[model samples]
Target chain A: MGYPRLSIAEIREGLRRKQFSCVEITQQHLKRIEEADARLKAFLTVTPESARARAAVLDQALAAGEPLLPLTGVPIAIKDNICTQGVRTTCGSRILSNYVAPYSATAVERLEAAGAVIVGKTNCDEFGMGSSTENSAFGPSRNPFDLERVPGGSSGGSAVAVAAGEAVGAFGSDTGGSVRTPAAFCGVYGLKPTYGRVSRYGLVAYSSSLDTIGPLARSVADLAELLQVIAGHDPRDMTSHGSAPDRYTSGLDAALRNHRVGVPFSLIEEGVEAETRRAIHRALDALERAGCAVEEIALPHLANAIDTYYLIAPCEASSNLARYDGVKYGYRSEHFSNLGEMYQITRAGGFGAEVRRRIMLGTFALSSGYYDAYFLKASKVRTLLIQDFQAAFARVNTILIPTAPTPAFKIGEKTSDPLAMYLTDVFTVPANLVGIPALSVPAGYTPDNLPVAVQLLANQFHEKALLHVAWHLEQAFALKPAALAV
Target chain B: MAITLEEVRHIARLANLQFSEEELQAFIVQFSKILEHIEQLSQVDTQGVEPTYHAVAGKIDRENARSDVIHASFLQEKALMNAPESEEGQFRVPKVIR
Candidate 1:
C-alpha cells in the first residue's frame, strides 16, 4: 500500500475508527523514516522500538474504549535541543553528543501525556546558532522538495521530517527563524508562539531571552493543536507566563471577516526575489478574498533586526553556554593536565565551528572596550524593533511578509559565506527581536516546483489572530499537498 | 572584509578560549564577515526605547511554596560518575590560589 501524508486530526480519526492501529501507524512512520531519512538526514536518532511500545499502549487503550486525548496515536518528531529523559539530546553538537538528559523538557513531557508518540529527535545547527543545518556535527538536513537544496535551519530536520512524511508533525525551537524558515523551505506550516507562551524549562539554552519552542506540521490546524499541547506555565522556568493558553486550534473557526492585515513595504527590499514578491501579493489577494483588509504600512526600523539580533542573541548565548566549561557535565578531555587546559580542550574539542564562532563574537561584543559600543547600542536598537512592531500592530491585526526571500537553496551553497546566510533571516528575525507570535504557511510554489511560505506576524499573545488568517489562506488557497501517494 | 588575526586572538582571550594559530586564521575571516552583516542595526534610531529582556510581562508571584532542603543528590551522583579526580564525593582540581 502507498503511504499517505496524514495530519494529526486525520490520524486521530483513523485511530478512533479502528481503521489503523496505533502500532501499525507507528510502524509505517518508522518504515518511512528508515527509507527517507537516510537521504534527507532529518533525524539525529530514531527510536523505533520505543515508539512502537508507546503506540501499542495507546492502541490497547482505544480497543478498551478509554477516553482519548486530542493527539492520541499521532507520531511526532522532536528537535534534539529539547531534553528527552534518557534520550540523547545532542543539539547537533559534538560537545553534547554523548549527553543524556536526566529529566524531560516540560514540552516533551506534555506531548507524551497527550498520547503523541515521539518518533525521533531531529537534527539542527549546533546550539541553534546557524541559518543552515550544515553547521551540525552530523550533516545537513536536505530539503525534501529538492534533494540538493537545504531544508532550512536550525529546525531543518524537524521541518523536513514533516514535509517528507516521516511523521505527522514535529517540535522545533525558534531562536530567530529556526522553525519558520525551515518550514517555509520544506513546504509546511510552522509557528513560533509569543515568547513565554510555551515553557522553555527543558530546552537547552541557545539565547535565553529569545529561545521559544513551537510546532512544525503540514497545516495550520495541526500546528495549533501541537501548540495547545506544549504551551503552559511551568514553575521550573521563571519566565513562563501564568496566563491560560487559549484554545488555539478552536481559534481556527473565528472568521477572518473585517480583520486588518498589514504589510510593510520597506521589508520587501531591493534584494528580494521577484517570484517571492509575486507570491506575497498572491497571498495578500487570497486574504482580501477571505474578507481581510490589506493595507500598506511603513516599519522603518524593521531593517535593523538582523543586526540587533546578532548582538543580543550571541551576548546571551555566551552567558548561557558558559556552564559547559568542561567541569560540570558534557564534554571533558582526558589529556587536560590543568584546570585551564580542561576548559580549553573541552570547549575546543566539543563545539562545532559555528558554535565557537558565535561564542567568540559574543565574548568580543561583551568585552570591556566594545561593551558600550556593541552590546549596549544593540539593546537600544532591539527596543526600537519592538516599538516598530507595536506601532504597526496598533493599526493592523497582523503583519504579513514572505518567510524567506527565496525558496530552498543548494546544500553547501551559503555555508562558506556567513554574511549571505545571515541575510536569509532578514524577514523573520524581526518577530524574534520583538517577541511576538508568527506563523509560516505555504503561499505558493516556485517555477522549479520548490515551495514559498508567507509569514503572519501578530501582536503579543495574538496567536489566535495569526492562526485564523493562516487557516483562511489554507482553506481558500488549498495550500496542503493534494497528492502524496507514493 | 575579513577580521584580523589580532582581533581573533583578542576575542579568544576575552572568551577565555585557547585556539591554535590555524584555527585563529580561519576564524578571523568568518567572524569578520558575520559581524559585518550584523552591523546593519547601527542604522536604526532607538532613542529612549527600553530593551525587552523578558517577554513574560507580569511580576512573578511567589506566594506558593518555600523549600529549606536543597537536594544535592543529582550533583553528587554526576560528580561521582564523571569526576576525573575526587575525594569524599567532592570534585578535586589543582589549586589555582597560591
Candidate 2:
C-alpha cells in the first residue's frame, strides 16, 4: 500500500479506527526517509531501530485496545540541536559530531510520552548561527520545492522533512527566524512560541535568551497540537514560564472577526521583493475580508532589528559556546602542546567558518573596550524593539508581514555575502527579540511556483491569537503541498 | 568601525580560536562588513532605555520550587561518555602548567 498524506489529526483518527497498524505507518515513513532524504539531506540521523521498537510497542497497545495518546504512531523528526538521550545530537557541526546526548530535552520527552515515534534528528546550521543550512557541517538540506534553491534555515532540514513527507511533523528551535524562515521556504507551518513558553533545557545553546523550541508541520492544526504537547513549565528550566500552556487547538475555531491586524507598511516597502510583498498584501486583504481590521502602522525601529539581533545573539552565543573547551565533552584537538593551545586548536578545527566568525564577532563585542559601545547599545535597542511591539500591539491584536524578504533563493546565491543572508530574517527577528509568539503560514506561491509565506505576530504569551489568525489564513489560501519530484 | 588585522587576531585569541593567514584575511573583510552594518545601531537614540538582558521582564518567580529533593543524576560513566578523553572517570585535559 502507498503511504498516506494525512495531517496529524487524521493520522491519530486513522489509528483509532484501526485503519493501519502503527508499525506499518512508521515503517512507511522510515522507508520514505530512506528514499527521499538521500536527495534532500534533511535528516542528520535516522533511528529506524528505535522507531521500529517503539512502533511495535504502540501496535501491541493498540491490539490490546488501549486508549491512544495524542501522537500515537505519528512519525516525527527533531532538529539536531535538541537533545535526545542516547541519540547523536549534532547541531550541524563537527564539534559535536560524535557526541550523544545523555538526556532528552523536555520537548522530546513530552513528545515521546504522547506516543510520537522519533524518526531522526534533522540537520541545522552549526550552533544555529547561519541563515542557511549551508553552514551545516554535514551539508545543506536542499529545498524540496526547488533542488537548486535553499530551504531557508537554520531549521531548514526540519521544515523540508515535513514538506517532503519524510515525517508527519517535526520540531525546530527558533532563535531569530530559524523555524519560520525554513517553513516559509519549504512551504509548511512553523510556530516560534513566546520565549519561555516551551522549556529550553536540552537545546544546545546558541543564544540562550532568544532560543525557543517550536513545531513545524504541514498544517496549522498539527502545529497547534505539537505546541500544546510540548509547551509548559519545566522545573529543569528556570526561564520557562510558570503559567500552564493554553489549549492552543481550542482557539483554532475562533473567528478573526473584529481582530485588528497591524501592517507595518514601511517595513515591507523597500527590502521585500515585489512578489513577496504582493503575496503578503494578498494575505492581508484576505484577512481583512475575513473580518480582520487590517491597518497600516509604523515601526521605525524595525529597520534596525537585524543590526541589534546580530550583536545580541552572537554575544550570547560566544558565552554559551565557551563550555566546549576540549575538556569535558565534544571534539578535542590531537596536536596541542598546552591547555591554552588545546583550546585554540580544538575550537578552530571543530567550528565551521560561520561559527568561528560569529564567535569572533561576539568576542569583539563583549571584549572590555567594546562592551558598552556594541553589546550595551544593542541591548538598549532591543528594549526599544520590545517597546515598539508593545506600542503596536496596544492598537492591534496581531501584526502581519512577509516571513522573509523573498522566496527561497539559489543555494549559493547569498553564501558569499553574509550581510545579504542576514537581511532575509528582517521580518521574523522582531518577535524573537521581543519574546512574542509568531507563526509563518504559507500564504501563496510565486509565479515561479516557489512558496511565499506571511508571518502572524502576537504579543507575549498570545500564541492562541496568533494561531487563530494563521488557521483562518491557511484555510483561505488552501496551499497544497508541492510535489517532491525528486 | 574598521577592524585591524591585529584586532581580529586579538578577538580570535579571546574566543580561544586560531586561523590561518588566509582565513584571517577573509575574516577581517567579512567582520568589517558586519561591523559596518551593526554600526547603524549607533544612529538610533536609546537614551533613557534600559538594556533588556532577558526578553521577558521581571525576575522569574522562584516560588513553587520543586522540593530541594536530590533527584537521580546521570552516572559518572554516562556523563563522561561524550568526553574526548577520560582517565579514572575524569575528563582528561592537556597540561596546564609548565
Error of 2 at A123 (Å): 0.7
Candidate 1: lDDT over CA atoms?
A: 0.84
* Cα lDDT of model 2 by residue, A139-224, tens digit: 89999888999999999999999988899999999999999999999989999999989999999999998999999998889999
Question: In model 2 chain A, where is the ten-residue run with the lowest total lDDT?
Answer: A1-10
Model 1 residue A312 lDDT? 84
In model 1, state the lDDT of residue A277: 88
Model 2 steric clash pairs: none
> Which stretches in model 2 have alpha-carbon errors above 4 Å?
A1-4, B64-67
Query: In angstroms, how far off is A217's CA in candidate 1?
Result: 0.6
Please provide TM-scores, in order, for all candidate models, with all chains considered together: 0.94, 0.98
Q: What's the true lDDT of residue A469 in model 1? A: 88
Cα TM-score of candidate 1 = 0.94
RMSD each, Å: 2.5, 1.3
